[model samples]
Target: MPQATKLSAPTAAPTPALPVRGQTDHLRLIAEMTREFTASHDYQTIAHSALERITRYIGAEAASLFLLTDNGETLACSACYGPVDITGLRISAKTGVVGRAVQTREGSMVRDVSEDADFGASVDAKTGFTTRSLLVAPLNIGQDCLGAIEIINRVDGDGLFEADDLVLLETLARAAALAINNYRLTEQIVQQERERHELELAAEIQRDLLPQPSSREFPIHGINIPARSVSGDFFDIMTLPDGRIWFNVGDVSGKGMNAALLMAKTSSLFRCLAKSAEHPGQLLNAINSELCETNSRGMFVTMVGGLFDPATGRLTLTNAGHEPPLHFDLRTERFTPIPADGPPLGIMPGIAGSDGYAVTEIDLAGGMLYVFTDGLTEATTFGGGMLGIDGARALIRDHAEESPDIRLKSISGAVKLPGQSLRDDLTLLVVEDMMTARAASMPPPRLEAMSTDGEILRLRVPARPDRLKLIRAAVEQAAKYCEATEAWTFDLTMAVDEACQNIIRHAYGNRPDAGDIVVDFIRRGDCMEVHLMDFAEPVDPSKVKSRDLSEVRPGGLGVHLIKSVCDEAQFVPPPPGIGNLFKLTKRLPSKLQ
Candidate 1:
């Protein structure tokens, strides 16, 4: 054996002096090596294959491949084919002959390691292998140093690396750089796909926690739109077992996955606690305490909650540092805000500086209560202008006369307009009182001849405030004729009086000259039914809201009283030619039955 000789020593010039046949043979071998580099995508496989190809081409005994880490501070040996296994080793990208090649973006050759200043003896010192001639090439792509490849002690031909070897190794390193970069890009794409799938699942779970819009008893409707894959805002409305409706809207402090998780927790706590809680304040107190204890992220919630009693037409509400709700007044055709009275949830437990959560009551005479998160008010227009409080009020007023369904659609459409970007989650809820509304929009009574078979009493009186006495008296007499109890008679009379007064005052707008108010007392199979009709201007159903009874109010208690006394009190829209038809049905006891 010729000592397994390599071609010349590393002291050779840039272009080696070689015979025509040898130079041609080197070119053919390099073409085959380039094909190997383009064939594989596995990083380790590519690095291992490059090391074997480069070492064999230069007739060297050992080789190693190092790649830069993501942080760019160090290079990690990804593969090795040498006397000692140095795989998985890490070093600074500023270290030995490999570092010099990477730093200068060129290749280097050392004829003798003992005489070379850049030779790092750490590898040889550990492996106890004597070093001699070697070649180093930087794995570079577009001026970026990915890493380097090194070939050690030549064992063939002249036992040294030549200038020709330098040229071949540098070319091979360029191809290896591309393969590494491709593998890195593929890993990044896979990671992003996994995160996207998780967000979608979170969005579904959040939507399931929401209460569906299917309550006709309260005529409640709303919509929620998220700025991202998940939302930080939510609205909930549930009719309690006791015929009372509880509704609330909340906004978390942030957006994305973290905010979505917090929103779900807040909403779940509300649904669980609101079932047994009596007042809006009590519900808020329990919810605030629960959230403060488990909330480690320090995120807070701004919320507005309300309880509506359809029987009494009373709405009790609590606002916890949230945007004020827009009150659409049908009488005045204006919008008023229900301001917040306490701080937001998770802002330090119980109401700050106050004894407890302050409850605000409103006797919805005939108006709509519109509640929403700040996302609606803070939304930006195409011109980059915010839809401030005033803008929100104006928008609600514009659709004040619309039905709940249309109103919700219009609001959602305005907030999520085409080509406009949403910066936060949006939520809106609307509650309306249609009884008072139907009374104000009375038409003339349709009097052809209702079956008089069970007619107990019938009276046609002038629609005047003074004649309310006659209406009540007639109702009391009819109750007595039907053998009704004292309690039944009193409640019927009072309920009849309220219905007539609401007609004379609100329906006719206190104009006695409007028309006659028809009062009919009919006895059905097992109940007493009274039908009253008044001719007046048709009222917008969305404008009627009962007055708040907690306050020392002088008037507006008539509708609340009638609804409380009558088992079934509803404003029947006049059929065709009829005015506002007010029907009050009360079940009679066995004696009257």
Candidate 2:
């Protein structure tokens, strides 16, 4: 019967299905996607191309590609292709089926998503799309999971996503993962470059804002160093038209752009109001009020400002919640701390109250004044210790004899000597009550005559405040020899005393050891001329003018007396190696019949 069942045409053998066609297509899809991923370095472009390809190939209604946030706690949707744009959407990396894929570095298939325990329907609810099925695959390269690629609501009315789809999608996910990482790294480099450029520009602006050593006699110097490219610490030195100097040192609360901007505004205010305000306290009050009006960031500034008169050795100081200043006494070789006068600026409006900020006056004769921010005291060392206030005081006391510039450099070098980079800004301001670097470096003065006019009575004496009476007596005797009237004798004596006092106080910086002054009285036809020479610092020519007569002030009267009493008063170039030569001349009366 088996033989008879018949070969019956042997039933045409079924043709075996070709495996090459399907395999070739899958490989072609991978190759094409790889080319697209490498075409451009832009994150958005790569992400968009990947999402579009996956959504169309998988027959899905929507697909979203997410990358882990910088914090790695959440996933931010980078690209989307679907009924709704979810490019900026964010979701927790631990919340749903997507979380499972990223956590396990595997594939997830959810059919009838409503029935799945881990299926979060929030996205579906948000987009108003009814999701029937979803497939999520981890975008992983080695052990690092970049995030997940999710396809939702398949276009086909299939029962569920197949196992084959998961394997195919994971392969595509690997290529996309690398592209995402490259884009992210490139973006990070670009961001760093942009910040670097901004910092350089800010540094340049800050440099221009700082003061340079313009004065030939003023002994004030300051320096600012930033932890980053921009500094929050700032110091200002301005010479007023009335021969007084205004100086300040300040530290903003933080560092970088915000603090830098605040510092610029604060310093500008100090410069603008310095002329109109008479006292340091008044200037600070105006600055505080102005800063409070626009300081929405709640930042504060700790600062100290002073008005110094080189002519009188008087310094009026006003401190605003800053580190106490150190007054280094040249005679005692010690530092006395000057405490703060009020709270910091920008903390509250009307901080000065009804009377205004408190003012403190101190005589800086035979000493140096130092004001600095907290950075100098709070500089950290590798041993976890800080350069405290006591250490800073000792440093200043040790370098008391050096020039202000040299002393500041020494302090800064010691602060950063640990070789570690600074974590804060450093600022130092120094005003010495001694001859300036220029004067100290100059040789002794010698008498040199320009021309022979008449017989001269010359006298050389120590340039000291105590010897001023002797100078007046000598000048009076000379006036009598010239047959000057009694009234003229009194005016000439007073003028001589004022001139010597100016030399002793301003040019010599109130130093007792400053060189001697030479006074020569010459009687020419119809005129009497006196010449004064000293080996001291030259006075600033721009600061030689008289103050407004209407405005009342304690100092500036010396300049007024010299100009008012003499018919001609001027500064002349000193003999070679000398510091300064001042000339004063008065018209003599005609001989009576």
lDDT winner among the candidates? 2
> Residue by residue across 173-215, what tens digits does model 2's lDDT show?
9877877677678779989999999989988898788888544
Query: Residue 305 lDDT in model 2?
Result: 91
Please give me the total number of clashing residue pairs in predicted model 1: 29
What lDDT is obtained when candidate 1 is compared to the true structure?
0.76
lDDT (10s digit) by residue, model 1, range 1-593: 12122223333212222323266666665666556655655656766766776666667777899878857778888898755568988877787888788778888999788888878888666666657888888888887888888888877567677787788777767766766676678778868988899999999999987877664434567788888879999989888887788999999998888899999999999999999898998899889889888887778999999998765556999999899987775534567789999888976777545567889999664567889988888888655699888878877767764567767778767767696658888899987765532443544434333453366766777888788887787887777777788899899899999888888878788875887787878787778889886656665434544578898879888878988889988775442223577788988767724
Q: lDDT per model, in order?
A: 0.76, 0.78
TM-score of each: 0.66, 0.63
Please list the Cα RMSD from the true structure of every candidate, rounded to 1 decimal place.
Answer: 14.2, 16.8
> Which regions in candidate 2 have their CA more than 4 angstroms from the true location?
1-41, 56-62, 67-76, 82-105, 110-134, 141-146, 152-162, 213-216, 296-298, 332-334, 380-390, 434-593
**Best TM-score goes to which candidate?**
1
